[model samples]
Target: MAAIYMRMLGYTVTLTMHGFNMFLMNNLLQGPVMEDPNIRTFSAMYKRFFTVWTMFLQIFVASLGLTSDYLTLKYSNKKEPYWLGVMRSMKNRLFAAILWPTVFLVSTFFWSLYHYDRSLIYPLFADKILSSTANHILHTAVVPLVVWELVFQPRSVPKSHAVNVAMLTVYMSTYFFVMYYTYLEKGVWMYSIFGIAYDTNICFPLIISFIGVMLYIYYHMQWFLTQIVWQPQAKIKM
Candidate 1:
């Protein structure tokens, strides 16, 4: 979905995919190692292996998605059975839901990077454009893509509200900590809303509250996609 949107928006799909992938690998692996000495040695080794694995995986998925889209369009007139049409429509919608948020997040990050000093960005690799693009593909594209597939795919049962909230909390907390670390290390603002002049003495608490609110919004969006879009369609008879 992101690829399609990017293509429609006249951005290079390859570059967008590459940028997102690099972002994920750097954040999940290298960022932790750099911030915590306890994680440095083993985490560094894991990061190298994970980077290679992720690169291959992203390329394969991107190719597969493009091929699938091509085939779907190319054979659209060839009269599919009712079930096939239903399946195809569901697949396409699911792809769109997954793709849209990724593009939103990646575009947001990229725009932020453009406005702020590179040094101030989290997932340190994003500081360099090439590295940042790679990071974006890995982090922004691959990780989220896989996550959507595993956790939010059409056949998967929706998680309970408690579980959903817990998962969302953990995810937001990790991002918040990483952002805080990035701010401390660079002594510059990456996100203008949380700029240094905001007075950490008061602003820090507000920032934390803001993240909680954002997480709630994210969860609600996920719930709406799963419950309102995918599941009802899945239940309809072809």
Candidate 2:
């Protein structure tokens, strides 16, 4: 009952955050920024951001958690295990394996680079375009939501770590391909780091390697944290 209520709260929060972000983004798109022809040409790229991708994943996992929890709570004595199993599997595989790592990476990387030099990941001028509230919701609030899910929701290590990592790789590769394609089309890199004048050949590969390492680290971090949460409970039951 407690877990169900907690997840319901999380789902509500995730939905509200996503809704506010969508509202802010819509306003930005339809507002004066679009009046600038140059900005308008690149406005479509906003959807391609990793933060945006993780936000969608967050909402998905939250919904999955809420549904699975609700069913479990309502049908505790019933025998409808199939759908519950499916929902839990999807939530564990997608949320624990992929979403956590990606969200962690985005939040950490964005804020770290943002504070060191905003121009690398996000431009200083973009502050005027994107409100601080929206920016924090995207980059800041996301971390706590993932952490809250990890801490509050009982989770097991994903059944197939390899498959989970493969899906993450595919998602990441698609984004990289998009960035490359955008660069080819517009003659400008989506990120300033890639546009650096020196040693441009090494930039993309280096960044990709770094991201791969970070994601792997965060994946293991999630596993370790899950153990911390569930291991003691398992022992007590035994």
- The numbered model that scores best in lDDT is 2
Off by over 4 Å in 1: 1-132, 135-152, 155-159, 174-199, 235-238
Error of 1 at 238 (Å): 24
TM-score of each: 0.41, 0.89
- For 72-162, candidate 1 gives per-residue lDDT tens digits of 5567689655655565444444333333333344445444655675543344443432355555554455545544442333432344456
lDDT of 2 by residue, 174-228 (tens): 8888878888887777678777732477776787899989998998898798788
> What ranges in model 2 sit over 4 Å off?
158-160, 197-199, 232-238
Candidate 2, residue 68: Cα displacement in angstroms equals 2.5
Give the distance in Å from residue 237's predicted Cα in candidate 1 to where it truly belongs: 20
Which is the leading candidate under TM-score?
Answer: 2
Model 2 lDDT, residue 43, Cα: 76
